[model samples]
Target chain A: MSEFEIIRDIFAPLTATAPGAFNLVDDAALLEQQNLVVTKDLLVAGVHFLAKDPLDLVARKLIRANLSDLAAKGAKPLGYFLGCVWPKHTDRASIEQFARGLAEDQERYRIGLYGGDTTVHSTKTGPLTLSATFLGTPPKQGMIPRSGASLGDDLYVSGTIGDAGLGLAALRKEFKFTTVDKASLSSRYHLPEPRLTLGTALAGLATAAIDVSDGLIADAGHIARACGLRAEIDAVAIPRSAGAASWVAAQENRWRALATLASFGDDYEILFAAPPAMRRSITVASKASRTEVARIGTLSRGEGVLFLDEAGRPIPVEKPGFNHFT
Target chain B: MSEFEIIRDIFAPLTATAPGAFNLVDDAALLEQQNLVVTKDLLVAGVHFLAKDPLDLVARKLIRANLSDLAAKGAKPLGYFLGCVWPKHTDRASIEQFARGLAEDQERYRIGLYGGDTTVHSTKTGPLTLSATFLGTPPKQGMIPRSGASLGDDLYVSGTIGDAGLGLAALRKEFKFTTVDKASLSSRYHLPEPRLTLGTALAGLATAAIDVSDGLIADAGHIARACGLRAEIDAVAIPRSAGAASWVAAQENRWRALATLASFGDDYEILFAAPPAMRRSITVASKASRTEVARIGTLSRGEGVLFLDEAGRPIPVEKPGFNHFT
Candidate 1:
């Protein structure tokens, strides 16, 4: 059992009666009366980020994570609440930098800093922890829920996957990329671009949607578990950057490399389920947002996520997603 | 400077432009369009609770802290979003206990579990941190802000205060009680009883209000600054528990002991301002809620909080309130 399992077994049941909570399966919750979608995430230093990461980037990443959750729910940013356990040594100057980062993001994302609380943790040696609760609203159609993935729906993902995962590896010096610039890889890991445009465009077009925070198989499995269906993702069909493709080509074990890329977490791209008939709409959406969307799999009457090769043979997954304490 | 000062100097300015945020001075932010009042608080181990504290009490305190914020704003609980960073060794049993505590409070408060996120933080030796964001609405009339204390307003505080402060001291073995039971003091420190009824009643009657967190003097200073006035607190008029009074009476430095008991933090009681004309209304409200209201101070044309003795001379204040990184 992992963090996700603990949530499902112990916490998800608490949300069973709350229709908007989506059983804690979807990225965000919806308030129909308020017409607001809300999601909260806590990021701690050390476990969530490198201990010495810049405070500015730390603040930005915290907000972006919540923004990514909103994007997955097909909602545009409205406002947010922030709660922080400030490291004991944080001075006014450091706090100013953190606030500056949040200000910049609020302006960029058209969200306001609504309210929050700040406390000092005297003994915590790790990076300061921050929790952000983002409130959003769909610009147009109703929210695309994660539980409506009917059988035979085409599974599509936005942008390329595994950049962030590899980026993290690169940060730790565990992996090197000759094809991709180190800065590019690291930026992907540091800052996640929330696909708000594509998600809003998804509206009624995608029956089910989720942001890929966990690895491809793991997050996709969320839709499967929620919709009570199975998802088959083609490893070959997953879009990859030229750098990623080159890195995979350079690997001694190609399939394992591909699995590593696919299973690493923090993609932040929207994975969606829609019927083939709506492929044209998805195409238009991709074109509109100028973000690529690739058809990677299909949904059927089953459970869990299946990773298949070009010839439709099964590919074993070593790490399905970012589940803590697995 | 204190934690509140840091927030005001660093973070409050960021919120000045967002009218919905109320300059981050009020207990909660009003999302008028959403018809929601929101407040968020982060509770960290060591700072907010002991590492070995019961998970049930941890969850309860987290929710109660946010509930206190809502109560201070004269808002009744609607729902909340929770974000928690689980400690590495957190098991299913602890999580279940936490959820049970939350369930009990939700039932007691009539608020729903809207949504939230969970994550595991390994390497955290201290207690896990939790943040709760409460969404509420005014129970009646408009919100009782902190800024409306007129020059001649009478300041009133609901319930006893020093109980919680002394309770914390008792928990840390800094204080011992023979006049009161251990459970009474420990409960005061662990579980804050939010004065929702008193707050709601004061919504229209009280000119200004704030929750007594961060100690009486510190929090009272908030209303003073917000109202651009002065608060003259009569030390003798301050409410205290039998245990706290007994402890203070036994001390050689009686004034300092009294001040320490009065200024210790974690009392979620509501301190409010109303004109002398509203005394009848305050009495009625107190009777209705079955909570005692003590008139301890007065607001006048000045600034800062002043502690006065029975002879109207200043009682030198020390440890005015709780401030982190002071």
Candidate 2:
């Protein structure tokens, strides 16, 4: 699997950054003469993915996670470098399947494999750890960081929240789901749509932006702290997919369920803030990118991410996002 | 150690790719408008280094390993992205030590931590796996890959070889060594001096070049195949340190010991080939870099690599380098 004999064949062809990269025959890869965006993510098996998860899906998840960071920053994908640490049991067939996933995404995203390293650890007995260092071009409006939000800016989020978290819960048998429901929820957890076009379109308009890898409340808190503003997200205004809506509708305490759903992580949608004056521009960006953006609330001269019910009453949050330490 | 709480303190200041990186507050880092070089290397404990190895040494080795690749391509250090998967037992002190190592090396080589991701992997039971994606600017002469070796070119290698392999063997107790000997060999094994200046100097002078991460003979073979030429390495001309020299001298069968040492990977020295006409330039490069370059071989019109004894006879290679399966 991770043996050099087969991996060499798979890796060599992937190194197609010619002219500058020297087809990766050279030790390093070359970057464009522009302000390149660099981001990295570490995905550990058992933590990032299930052991039974297809290698192809795992590969896609890895690429998409890093790509999501770029999209959040209003950057365009250029290329990426991968580093994988394989366990002893990994074989050539497994590696080939993983490459197939990467190949599919590379074609879809129009990114090349600049260079990478694949190492085999014979003594490793746990889940494999994989990482990617993604490179890209900055948006015309430059980088949109979380620390740019301002007071009175309207907070908006793209796509539906809580679907991924519910999907994971269903997968773990914490809840029941129909065949169609399972597919929709699991796929949401597996394949996150990195809002590249929407993020790019919002580059000049959105004051601050972040991809919702963590839970909505938690990530909003990051933007809030960075800009020294309070993010007041109206829970009733939070968008939800049909599947998520139906799931929550079945619960007796619907608002509580909504709160629970929004608090779970893994939604790779764009959450951003923009002044009310840019509402027209924001609508234009959403229409042009064909992505929906819902106005949740506004930033105030306060601290942390605050949630409000329909009556505008503050709702206390016990947990914000995923924490490594339980 | 990998906890986001304390890690926040360590990671924020390391985002020295300022003005573009947004002080690690942004989702990504930005590069300058130059011919950028990108390379990544995965270092796994118990595989790339000893599990008991000091964290500082581990950090230096990781940075140097990636830097070595860039050096081979005639690239100067710029910045790097780090992806670290921490096992359960790691903690704040360990991460601090690791950061200190990176800080020391960042000062040693002019590079910065552009961005990085650190994740807690409680399931991982093996030695930590740390990966770095290094970015650099190529020399004005451009990148020198393995595919440019011309016929009748002189083969040159920087520093010494086999010391790493021997050092590993000595560490494994396969060979005995005194305190001075052990320190010299282990340091060579742990701390590889990337031939940055020499490689930049060799950019135009050398026809092709590669860093000796794999064994010297094996890497020479790569250039041979890339250039469609045969490499004839005079084994006796291969350089050695005083410690290695004395160890080999003490052996009953010095050639066997030499072969073993040469075949051991991890010697991050530069091995290059250039036309004899560029002797003056090569000499000037050596002088400027203050690094010794030894002519150990020649390129001939043929295929693969051939090792020659003092008598100019071909010596068979049973195992050219380290194979993961073995």
**Which candidate gets the maximum TM-score versus the true structure?**
2
How does model 2 score on DockQ? 0.64
- Going through the candidates in order, what fraction of the true interface contacts does each contain? 0.36, 0.78
lDDT of 2 by residue, B1-326 (tens): 22446546886777664456667776787776777878889888888889888998899999999899988989898878888877766777888898889889988997888888877776647458899988888888887778888789999999998888878888899899877888899889989999998988888888899899889988888888789999899888889998888888899876766666667799999999989998888989999999999999899988988888788887777788876645
Candidate 1 lDDT over B1-326, as tens digits, reads: 22234334433443333344434332223332455666777888788887778888888888888788777777878777667777776666676677778767777887766556666776755348888888777645766777777898999998887888778777778767753555688899899998888777777898888888778887788789778999999988988887777877889987777678668888989988999998998999999988899999899888988888788888788768766754
lDDT of 1 by residue, A184-281 (tens): 87888888888888888888899988888878888888789778899999898888977678778889987788888889888889999999999898
Kindly report the docking quality category of candidate 1.
incorrect
Question: Looking at candidate 2, what TM-score does chain B attain?
Answer: 0.96
Which residue pairs show backbone clashes in model 2? A1-A91, A1-A92, B1-B91, B1-B92
Instruction: Note the Cα lDDT for every prediction shown.
Output: 0.76, 0.84
